[model samples]
Target: MKALIVYGTRYASTTEIAAEIGKVLKENGFEVDIKDSRQKDIDVEPYDLIITGSGIKIGSWTKETLKFLEKNKEKLSHKKIALFAVCGATRDDEKQYQEAQEKYLDNIQEKYLTKPPVAMGLFGGVIDPNAKYGIMDKLIMKMVKKDLENKGIDTTKPYDLRDWDEIRSWAMELASK
Candidate 1:
């Protein structure tokens, strides 16, 4: 089987996650191709399975991911599809995590990718001050970090909340199906 994994990332964390997913898929005996959504166009019709993901920014997906879904909705609907989202809300609270999942995944599914995916994943994201950010973004993150800390969540240092084991397990499960 052939699988294609495409992702939209800002600070490169989502790209790393997509790469890991592709690696596990390959290990499970599927031929896999991975691409950044910002790259040149490629047809999705050749792949037997399609997986797409994005890092959430203000409860919205990257424009590239949205465009890809919109442009290929028909072809994707005919293939086995899986979707994932990366966001920092999972690091805070259960209610926040659920809300993020609904806003980032469920709503996106309902609005753009109308075809149901075989599986969907909600993964925690990283927060790094060193990463490139505009003045407003940096200011916002500072406040966010302070708020998290006040809530008894340690945000004094960079946070990488991804669960590698869970990611690999999910990829393996997708391969099996």
Candidate 2:
């Protein structure tokens, strides 16, 4: 089957995860197309399955991914589709992480509840405090860092909490059906 993997990333962490998913899908004998959500236009009709993802920033999913879904809602409803989100907060609290996923899914579902996507997945994201950030993200990260420090949390180690095996298994299951 043919699949399209589309994503948006601010720090490039989500893009990495999306690419990994594409790789695993290809290894499982699926023809996969990986595209950045910033594309001016997209043709969803060409693919049998569509998987879209984006990085979460400040408790919100990227705008590009949301726009893509809204733009192709009708076409997506007719195809096998899935959604994923990548965020650093996902690693700290499983319940909160899941709530974030549900929030995004709810937004999409509210728009297309009559015809929802086939499935959805949530994945952990990478965090690099030293990475260049805009004024707002910088300030936010600084506060987060302070809070973590007050709680005696280590901030030096960069963590990539994504589960490649889980991603592979989900893609394989979708492709098999």
Candidate 3:
């Protein structure tokens, strides 16, 4: 089978996850193409499976990914599509994280896109306080840091928290189908 893996990432974590998925799929004997969602255009009809992922920021998927899905809803519905979101919040609170991710999926479903995504996944994201950020992002991070500190949460360490085995398992199942 052939698969297309598309991703939208701001700090490159989601992109790394997407590439890893593609690598695992390829190792499992399926042909795969990995691309950034910002590509000028995507020809989705040629692929047997479509896997799209994005990093979640402020309880929402990236705007570029949403736009890609919105623009390709018609063509996408005819193929096997899988969705995933990378977020730091999901590491500790899966339910809340998934609910936030579902809002994006719900929007796609509401658009009347037949055959919505067959599978959805959430992966933990990376957060580096010292990393460069835009004005708004910096402000938001500062607020979040303050809140976490108030709650006695330590924010000094960087944790990956992504389960490679789980990711591989998911890809294997999708490839087997």
Candidate 4:
């Protein structure tokens, strides 16, 4: 099978996740192509399977990803789609994880796309203070950091919440279908 993995990310973490997904798909004997949404326009027609993901920012999926979905809705409707979301909310609490799924994944499925993903994942994200950010992002991160501190969560270090084993498991499951 041929698969296309497309991702949208602000700090590159989601892109890394996409690469890992590609690697796992390749290992499973599938032909795969991975693309960064910011760098290129994608045509889903050539692939039998499509996996698209995005990092959440201020309760929004990246604009590029949304546009790609909107533009390619017809093509995607005929293919098998698996969607994943990356956000720090999953690292907080069960309630937050539920909210993140509702906001980031469910909403997109219900309102944005013409086709529903056969499999969906809501995964943890990364937070790195040292990463470059624009003034607005910096301000938002300051507020986020303050909130974490208030909850007794340390903001002094970067947080990586991606679970590679879980990611690979998800990919393997998808590949078997």
Candidate 5:
């Protein structure tokens, strides 16, 4: 089987998650190709399964990801698609997780897809202090961290909230589908 993993990342956390998914798919006997939407374009015709994902920012998926989807919507309609998204907001609460799924994953499916994905995952994301964040962006991140801390979330310096086990489980399930 052939699988294509395509995604957009803002600060590289989403990139890492996409890579992990690719690894799992490869282990399941797939010939996998991973593409970063910002740097490259792909012809989805050769792949049996295509997994697409994006990082969320300000309640939106990365623009490049949306563009890629829009560009290939016609061809993608014939393939098996599995969707996933990475976002910081999904980590803090159960309610927030569902909301994140609805906003980042479901809303996207509704807007761009004619058919529902065979699998969907809404996963936690990272906030790396080492990334090239601008002044305003830094301020916003700091404020968000402070708010979480104030709520007794024990915010760390560089928040690494990704749930690896859950991520792996999701990929394994996608392999079956």
Candidate 6:
């Protein structure tokens, strides 16, 4: 079987996650191709499975990911599709996880996709002040970091909030299906 995993990221964390998923799919006997959503003229019709993902910044999907979906929706509707998003909300709160899923995944499915995806994943994203952000973004992240800290969550130096176990488990399940 063949699989294509395409995604967009702001600070490269989503790119890392996409690679891991592709590796798992490969291990499960799939021939996997991973691409950045910003790439041009991608033909998804050749793949048996299509997985797409994005990095969420300030409660929004990366524009490139959205554009990719818009460009490929018709072809993707006929393929086995899965969606994932990396966001900060899925970090520590169960309720926030549900809300983020509804907003980032469910609502996106309703708007851009004709059929529901085979799976939708909402995972925690990293927050790092040292990343390549504009001055305004740096200021905003400072406040966001302070707020999370005040809530008793230790915003560690790197603040890498992802759950690798959950991500790997989700991929394993997808490979099974």
Alpha-carbon RMSD to native, per candidate: 1.6, 2.1, 2.2, 1.6, 1.7, 1.5
Error of 2 at 102 (Å): 1.7
Model 6: runs farther than 4 Å from truth? Answer: 152-156
Per-residue lDDT of candidate 2, residues 47-161 (tens digit): 9988888888887777888898888877787888887777765546878776776776666566643466676777777777667789999999888777767867677865566
TM-score of model number 3: 0.86
Q: What lDDT does candidate 1 reach at residue 69? A: 91
lDDT of 4 by residue, 15-111 (tens): 8889888999999999999988876668788999999899999999899988888888888888998899988876459898999999999998886
TM-scores vs. true structure, each candidate? 0.93, 0.88, 0.86, 0.92, 0.93, 0.94
Ordered from best to worst TM-score, the candidate numbers read: 6, 1, 5, 4, 2, 3
lDDT per residue, candidate 1, 1-177, as tens digits? 999998999888899999999999999899999999998786898899999999988778899999999999888878999999998876458898888889988998888775788888999888875566899898888787787778776665677889999889989899999
Distance from true position, residue 31, model 5, in Å?
A: 0.7
Per-residue error at 80 for model 4, in Å?
Answer: 0.5
> What's the lDDT for residue 66 in model 3?
78
- Computed on alpha carbons, the lDDT of every model, listed in order, comes to 0.88, 0.79, 0.78, 0.86, 0.87, 0.88
Residues 1-177, candidate 5, lDDT per residue (tens digit)?
999998998888999999999999889989999999886667899998989999888888889899989998989999999899999865558888888989999999998888999999998888764455888888887788777778676555667789999999999999988
What is candidate 6's lDDT per residue for 41-76, written digit by digit as tens? Answer: 888988999999999887788888899899888998
Give the poorly placed runs of model 3, Cα more than 4 Å off.
104-112, 147-154
Candidate with better TM-score, 4 vs 6? 6
- Alpha-carbon lDDT of model 4: 0.86
Residue pairs with clashing backbones, model 4: none
Clashes of 1: 0
